[model samples]
Target: MTTESAAYTADIEAIAQVVAAVEHSQQHKDPDEFLALFHPEAVWTTAGGKVLIGLDAISAFTREVLPAADWDGKVTYEVVHVFFIRPDVAAVKVRQRYLSPGAESEGAPLYVMSRQADGRWLLTACQNTAVATA
Candidate 1:
């Protein structure tokens, strides 16, 4: 593979890991592990527009919500447009589809992500709209 192709492959894999982390945390309800995917100072917006800042908030929020989640699903990154803001700092805009619990349904949940200093992607915002189809 060419240099560009290899870079593309790496990005794809990284995005896959991001989705997997969300699914895994949801299934296991492990907030500690889930919070590890985010930066210590990360900020997020909930579906209801609640603002959460920092890892502590992330842990608390995930712990509360994951247990109540009826849907254990994945966020497939349909489009991940990336940019390197600085040499070691990068950002991405991802369009994702969140499958319903048991991986059913034709609707997509809204999600936004940001990368941590350790090179991991974390959900910065998420919102679920009514499924477009049954």
Candidate 2:
């Protein structure tokens, strides 16, 4: 295999762990574990367009949102594209899908991003919304 392929694979593994942490936070409502994967200044936005900034906001939002969700679903993260902004930072476009369990079923592709630093990837910002059709 090529060196670039190997490096990209390793990067994806690291990012996948971060995604798992996010899912764990959602399923179990473990704010500390979720926040550990994010920088103190991380930002999160919901599919409906509400903006949340910083660790404090993220923590609060997680607690508020996760429990209220009747969503017994799972997420699969696909790396659409990655642009290395620097030696330690990259911008990633991802596709996320959630499998719903009940009658009201729907899934959407989200444009999300993360950044790597100190050999770790952290979710810097994300925008989740329904994909528009052309």
On TM-score, the leading prediction is 2
Candidate with maximal lDDT: 2
**What are the per-residue Cα lDDT tens digits for candidate 1 across 58-129?**
678888887786655443444445555543344555444556655654323444556566666665554533
Runs in model 2 deviating more than 4 A are 1-6, 73-75, 102-117, 132-134
C-alpha RMSD values across all candidates: 4.5, 3.4
Ten-residue region with minimum lDDT total, candidate 2? 103-112
lDDT of 2 at 5: 82
Candidate 2 Cα deviation (angstroms), residue 15: 1.6
- Model 2 C-alpha RMSD to native: 3.4
lDDT of 2 by residue, 9-79 (tens): 88767766776666666556566776787677877777778888988897888777766777674545555
